[model samples]
Target: MAENKSTSARAASAASSKTEADIQAQIDQLRGDIANLTKLIGDLGSEKASQARARAEKLRDDATKAGQEAYDRARDEALSMEEDLEDRIRMKPLQSILIAAGVGFLAALFTRR
Candidate 1:
């Protein structure tokens, strides 16, 4: 009976040691997997940031080009209006001068009071 008790104790100790070793190996494998996943996440974040910066730069360039086009269109319209006014003044110089003189006379009369 004493010999049987001793054999059972030895078996239990061996089994406990084997289980402990297996658990340690699993913990080490999980740590390695965690490290790899962290690195992959960081790389993806950097790639996404680079893509966002490129998109922002493209948008800024597009806005600048649109603003320049709008400025050119407005300048062309203003030039057309100026040329049209000049043509009308050349065709009726006396009328333009008379209107200017009338406005000036009215301004002067109002200020004299």
Candidate 2:
């Protein structure tokens, strides 16, 4: 009977040690997994930041190009209007001078207030 009790106790102790070792190994594995998760999150953040920067740069470039095109179009239209005005003035110098004088008189009248 004493031998039986001793053997049972030995068996229980062996099982307990195995359980503790298993728990320790699981804790180590969890730590490693946490570290890997943290690294993955950081890498993802970096990748997203890079993508955002690239997108912003592309948007900025697109806006700049659109602005330049609009400016060019406006300048071309202004030049066309200037040439038309000049041609009209050359065709009717007296009329052009009379229109300019009338516009200046109206402007002076409005500005007097």
Best model number under TM-score:
2
The runs of at least 3 residues in candidate 2 whose Cα sits more than 4 Å from the true structure, single-residue gaps closed, are: none
Q: Give the TM-score of candidate 1.
A: 0.73
lDDT of 1 by residue, 1-111 (tens): 999999999999999999999999999999999999999999999999999999999999999999999999999999999999899999999999999899999999999
Per-residue alpha-carbon lDDT of candidate 2 for residues 27-103, written as tens digits (9 for 90 to 100) = 99999999999999999999999999999999999999999999999999999999999999999999999999999
Clashing pairs in 1: none
The lDDT of model 1 is 0.99
Clashing pairs in 2: none
Task: Give one clash count per candidate, in the order shown.
Answer: 0, 0
TM-score of every prediction relative to native:
0.73, 0.82
Most lDDT-accurate candidate: 2
Kindly report which residue stretches of model 1 are placed more than 4 angstroms away from their true locations once superposed: 1-7, 103-113
